[model samples]
Target: MCSNYDSVTSPERLRIYFGVDAPAGSIKGEVWPLYQAPFIRRHPHADVGDDAVPPREAMAGLFGMLPHWAGEVAFGRRTYNARSETVAEKPSYRDAWRNGQHCVIPVEHIYEPDWRSGVAVPTRIQRKDGKPMGIAGLWASNRKATGEEVLSFTMLTINADDHGLFKNFHRPEDEKRMVVILRDDQYDEWLDAPADRSMAFMQQYPAQLLMATPEPQRGRRRTGASPTSK
Candidate 1:
């Protein structure tokens, strides 16, 4: 399951690609569970006979989904990635799934561990075309005891045991999984698809269209002074 990724940080790119003029608020480039990031969803008035309104809109949301019953924001940490197979059955996700609260996460890249060498190495995965990926996800809203409204989302993942590219990551004994990357043309369809038809969009992205490279962990520094220094 994906717990971290790079969010699309360019407003121009968000406008040109996702049709979102700008993010709802400032967001960090590196995203982890519970981090604020942008997600695209069908406009609330899209079906309300407003021809002048855009069909889609971008909004800032926590990277992990929070069901209404969740007591605190911490609940998001464990709900960051929802299994597509069980999304409709899991209590934390079934409400959003049943209500068709579909959304698309604009991701620059996703980091996963590469264990081919008997050690875990961080790997960055992105589209071979170098364009942002529109990942399928579910969005939900909750109100805290303090009456603060929070918007959140979770990436949808599917089995990747036979995928040529993703099968190489993670431990060999662990079940392989990868997020569902939607095509450019399917964004609107995904947002508007009914609950029964949602499963139709859960297909895996073509492995040939993706590329991966090793990326060292961030924020590491030398422990002591330089050799030539004091």
Candidate 2:
């Protein structure tokens, strides 16, 4: 599960890469559960018969998803990563999944644990080509008692038991998993896909296209260990 990640911070990057305009310094650099970050979705006007507006729009949202029944935003911590296999059946995610609330979470990199050496070492994983990844996700909106609207999202993850690179993370006894990183060309299709066809885009990203390195924790010294790529 991706509980932490680095979000794309530059508005120009968002406009050039994701084709959406966002104000500078609007998104946080690092994102954790409940942290506000930008996500891309099909513009509401597009579905309402507006032809002049852009098809896609970017908005700041909490990293974790909050269902309509959630009493507080803090519930996002456990809903940050929705398993692709059960998302449609899970109560917390079913509504968004059923409503075709598909979205893309722009990530600079994601952090996972490298338990290869018996100790859990923090590892940073990113595309080998150094491009921002648009991970497949679902977004939802909830209203607070004060009538304020809160938007949130969750990354969709798939089983990676046999994946070349991701199978090496986590512990030996745990079920391996990785986020569904969509190809650049699939961005529009993902947002427009129906629930029945969304699963087709949940395939794992190629191991050859990704690289991982040990990222020392705050105040920790850098290690001489070599980075890993399949």
Candidate 3:
């Protein structure tokens, strides 16, 4: 359900934050819903002098599934998130769950919403402490009709126990529950955890460290909002 996120993080910052050292200027955008970057994993060795982390080779993109994935390929509707709880039973994810694929999805922040007015008012979700947060994710390589190869991912979800970060997602029509929040020390385990332990890492939530900001609405008029002729 994490369809939008800020993919414009700096490579140095991303390296320090994710330890994979994405190539410079490789950050996607502020509201990314897909991974069509020509250089997806360009900087597999991004480094900012943080403690020794895992090698870039441990990272995997969605494309890894192609040239072999026999399932129907459709991304217009299929997304990245696979709830850890039922992954073992779901047709779209069960196979991947048991194999323990390694992946690292870098994100700066995400957009959630409040649909009280029957219209969604976007609320930007980030660390309450102003630090970036990484949501545990799974990626798959897909082939587009345009004949271009791409990678995409999804963020897992869970109930909002007390974070109040997304009570709006639980609305009657929403009924959304699942989330993917991880700690720095838990990254390795999350990226490589077995199906049994994946749940433990996916359920962290880390609400105490998260903060939400309502983005400002932009003026719609071509020139600008103006006083009516009196």
- Scored by lDDT, the top model is 1
TM-scores vs. true structure, each candidate: 0.93, 0.91, 0.71
**Per-residue accuracy of model 1 over 107-179 as CA lDDT, tens digit each:** 9999887899988787899999989999999999999623788999999999999998899888889888999
The TM-score between candidate 3 and the true structure equals 0.71
Q: Which model is ahead, 1 or 2, in terms of TM-score?
A: 1
How does residue 4 of candidate 3 score in lDDT? 55
Q: lDDT for each of the candidates?
A: 0.87, 0.84, 0.51
Residue-wise C-alpha lDDT for candidate 2, range 1-230, written one tens digit per residue:
77778998788888888999883235677877777999999998887776778999898988888887787887776788898888998998998999899999889999888899998887899999989999999999988622678888999999999998899888889889999999999999999999999889989999999999998682221332211100
What would the TM-score be for candidate 2 when compared with the true structure? 0.91
Residue-pair clashes per candidate:
0, 0, 15
- lDDT, candidate 2, residue 122? 79
- The residue ranges of model 2 lying beyond 4 angstroms of the native Cα positions read 23-26, 48-51, 218-230
Model 3 lDDT-worst window of ten: 221-230
Question: What ranking of all candidate models by TM-score puts the best one first?
Answer: 1, 2, 3
In model 2, state the lDDT of residue 26.
55
Q: Which of the numbered candidates is closest to the native, going by highest TM-score? A: 1
